[model samples]
Target: MSTENYPVVFGTEDILRSLCDSVSRVLSVTTQSQIRYSGMVQRISKTCLKPDIGCFVLFDGGFSGLVVINFSAPAAMELYEQYMLNMGMSKDELTTSHTSDEVSNVMGELMNQSVGDFTAKVARELQTHITQNQPKMMALSKQVILSVDTHLEKPEARRVTFFTGRNNIFYLELAIDRTEFIKLNDFDASEVPDPDALMDQVHGATAARPAPAVSGTSEHDELLNSLGM
Candidate 1:
């Protein structure tokens, strides 16, 4: 008799969960606020970009998919303000309206970061690569629905609800080709790198390095002299 362990199967819902986690992780860290998603996910017939603010990006390669994040006006403003404040911007310097071009740009940037993280995880965990287009953002006063233009023979759509620390709500919609990954062999997934730790390492190395020798009366020497070095 032959003994073998069962292969691990990752299906549609697993992929959706991974994408949701990426969004939560990126936004939470960037804004220095808590971001949580619904425990239940909705199986939708199609994905659409809804009113207030809508951002979308398309990815292709190992799998083709579309990601859409629709934010309510309040939710968009909350996240934008939080992120800006975390970056050391004062409240007076922040925009009050979600429809402002600056608001759209900031939201787009956040979406880009989130999707970039998701793609990296796909490469590491799924052992496949995917490339994403630049995120597109729109502010809409009325309801508007947009779908992916790319072809997905058997598309699966899902929507997950996300909440900001202030309890503002947003929705994430995903449409992807129905697919699965079955692990054939045992392997550990790569650990995600910690940005804070990486920055500390860089600073430590710089501090330990000797200053480069400067010719007579150079700006570097002048600075060092001013510091009584």
Candidate 2:
């Protein structure tokens, strides 16, 4: 078979499961909240992007990826209240008058710690060292689509929601390009002839087309079957 015929297969389910486990652990420890895995969403859409405040942390190693945790304003305020209460602050002292700077600082610290825990989990699963960029807050005013490769399938993404208590819900999103994802998992590339060259060729050929706006596991599975993986 030609070198180009080699199949590429990725286990997105396994990746999302691992991430869900990691987030559950981190949130439970830091926020003293009970977390339950809700469900997974295949695409980044307006419904899922409803949260206005979010913190994003970048992961870099064999592959580049991001871990984003989003919170509604009310949810953010609730989390802040819970955190302060945990720190021995009296409920009487807790007030809504706290400036954005104060709320953002606490949120940023929690996000930083959460990302640290997540990277540690990823390192164990991938058996490779993982480095993360500083976590930062972002406001989503409109819908945003992910970058995809025309030569390959769209990136795999899953959103896992965790219900704490009293209707407090928070979510984490994991999206990774299929090609880089395989690499991050330490897939064997020995059989491929010039893997880097092959990737360059494929990317060059698919450079002109725009990435797909929607994604699903079924679509990715179809692509995998077509590749004979």
Candidate 3:
């Protein structure tokens, strides 16, 4: 399989389109979607994007990660707003606690749909199975999620990112641990189709609308690398 992305077993556009469609279809509300730094997260070498409202990470459970996903600050806020709006609350009166809790709940469901779609595609392709549990909300700073002092185990840490739809930028530290990292190190392009063919489809699959500019490549890569894989 190709290293920049998972090898293209079936249709690349088919998978990504399914993912984007699934993300939009699953969310209960449409709360302004956007992206930041839509490119490679060099740190862990994970495919990442900085959404306007936040950032998030997706991982394979085979990596033995305790926490497989994470999101960013504004992402929390935007989701909190969506929850508030869905509940019929006025945006002006929203407070800190309400926003934090609401973001956690909304993002948790978002993680569910996203992971479900990802795993479903893999399962169908490999003819394997994966089951997902409820994802918990961090509701605190990005550091809080990683700090064992906060009681979130570190061993299971997977790739982290701040996926959002607002604008400024979001970040997540996606750690894959050494074990899974090794599996990826040996990966190549055998499973993927012609790079030109897949890249063509992958690029075409993105949003037609213009988006805000994101951060530098080196910076994004540093974040992904920290994730260990």
The 0-to-1 C-alpha lDDT of every candidate, in the order given, reads: 0.91, 0.64, 0.47
Runs off by more than 4 Å, candidate 2: 1-10, 45-50, 95-99, 139-154, 179-229
**Scored by Cα lDDT, where does model 3 land?**
0.47
lDDT (tens digit, per residue) of candidate 3 on 156-220: 22232334555533443333344311123333322534689888887877655578687566776
Cα lDDT of model 2 by residue, 11-110, tens digit: 6666667667776676566668775677655565222334456777677665556677777666677777778888888888776733366666777788
Q: Residue pairs in steric clash, candidate 1?
A: none
Q: Residue 209 in model 1: shift from native, Å? A: 26
Give the least accurate 10-residue stretch of model 1, judged by summed lDDT.
1-10
* Candidate 3 segments whose C-alpha is farther than 4 A from its true place: 1-32, 35-37, 45-69, 83-99, 141-163, 172-229
**Best model per TM-score:** 1
lDDT tens digits, residue span 102-192, model 1? 9999999999999999999998899889999999998876846666564788999999999999999999999999998878776777877
TM-score of 3: 0.45
Error of 3 at 225 (Å): 87
